[model samples]
Target: MKTDPTRYLARLRVTPGYEKAVPAPPSVGVLIVGYRACFAAAPAAGTPIASFEATTPVQIDAGAATAMALISVERATQRLRIRTEGGTEISWEENYFSAFGDSGTQWHLLPVDPSSHGGFVIARGAWAAGGYQAVLTRSTLIQAPFAPAVVSVHNVDPHTGERRW
Candidate 1:
């Protein structure tokens, strides 16, 4: 079975409180979205067996910055170079959101010291064959202290054009 296309939007919000602490850092930020595919019949739920991922860069502005990506998947075997501890081969037929992030730089996985920027994945779902459009939004704080970012996943019906979060 083939998976439907998914669109992801990453937004970086620079709050007023953050600005009061420090002016916008003169550097661009990076946003990453990752997908992990697991065997639909696997005994362990949400265990990854295969995967695909991508990233984009966003400039830190006074208010906000945004980035977007569109992706689709097809049913195919993904071979693993290294076998599992049990030496078992694996095949994945379903995909789900595995990770999301907003970082100070592309080289860093998370916001470094003095960056005050971060993000997280709030929701995830397995991709269904011939499914509706999936919309994923990640909102992150650029310089806000103790403020948590949000990541929301929604599915939009193709026929009725309705969104279900």
Candidate 2:
């Protein structure tokens, strides 16, 4: 079975009093805080899974002025990928680690199901950047051994925190 790709809008909020300055002035910095997970079609519920308010934000060399979260979900597997300009690509997988707690990076595993898995990839990062972008790709099963994949891209405006699909 083949399924058409779907797009969903998502947002990232700056943690109150959690912003930090980058070593190189005027450039952008990022501190990622993984909060919770939920379905892309639904809203995020419950408290955050992790917190980075107490941790000091790390300075990274980024000039793009935007952070990105690349989420991919395929049969029995899910991954969250993060990247910024001049920064190394960071990734978290559902089955790989229990809970990541290092250098302000954190993530939660998605709930498992027989047919498909559902969850949202929530994270917070402060940067000189304007907004955050999230791209989600999922393979959904409509029949046994046959699944169709859909992709969703979401952007949030830093000024208004408005989500645009």
Candidate 3:
């Protein structure tokens, strides 16, 4: 029961290096294409799991080696997976978007750490209490093992919000 990766959300501007910056934010929405994976014996086993893919190619420097993109899976942990040039996959232990709409940032400051994972956050019109919403506070460039890329942003749907994948 895999879903097709066919939607275009937004054009994300990935900064350079590991340095952090809260530049002018972009209008936001989920970017990756979402899919639900079902096991052959799923009903007898457990619930089906969801997965997502990067539909848009990442924009990196001309001489950059590694490339990174933000993605998410329905009902799965908000962990990040980085693929190496040799095809090796490294998974990050943070669900960065887990606290987007937390009590602290209802209509105030919403801070997002690039290393965490969870529900995806995007810029919204109103400061709503629920849903995947947040302002781009800081984006850090993850180094080595991946690409020579400078920075990247994670945009995905909230865990408990309506499924847009």
Candidate 4:
């Protein structure tokens, strides 16, 4: 599980045709204190977290299924805990990659405190029996129309592990 330390928005894909397609947008809620203080558009931190179940389960062979979870990690941990209500739970390191399958149970995790760092939510799920990449955005993309394109090059001395360029 790899996470972005500076990310605030966690986007997870809700794929259709797992058990059933989602008919409507699911309710999203956070479980962290001071969540609103940190993120304005994020859901209010609630007890037992918020339900992601739809009013009516829709089974579609076309279209798309998507959802976003706004979270604030005031406190940082070695790994972010991810668990589904009725599925497997796992912890992902800050920048390590991991894999998971689709279907079965919703998942959520939030750890907030002033002493902790930030992290991203990396999840793998199916949408219509296919795979897609989910993304988390802490800050909005910047548009630098007048700014020059910035290119970075790093030359490292193999034995010393020191930058040469």
Worst 10 residues of 2 by lDDT: 107-116
Candidate 3 residues lying further than 4 Å off, grouped into runs, are 1-4, 13-31, 35-101, 104-152, 155-165
Q: Write the per-residue lDDT of candidate 3 for residues 36-143, one digit (tens) a residue.
A: 222211111122222234322222222321121232222222344556654555443333444652221111112111122432232232211222322121121121
How do the predictions measure up, each by TM-score? 0.20, 0.21, 0.17, 0.17
lDDT, candidate 4, 1-165, per-residue tens: 443322322343433343253222222311111111221122332312222222011211112222223222222123445566555545534324223322221222232222212221222221111221223232311211221122111112335543211
TM-score attained by model 1: 0.20
Error of 3 at 70 (Å): 8.8
**C-alpha lDDT of residue 56 in model 1:** 19
Better of 1 and 2 by lDDT: 2
Error of 2 at 145 (Å): 25
Would you give me the overall lDDT of model 2?
0.27
What are the lDDT figures for the candidates, one per model? 0.26, 0.27, 0.26, 0.25
RMSD to native, candidate 1 = 18.1
Worst 10 residues of 4 by lDDT: 53-62
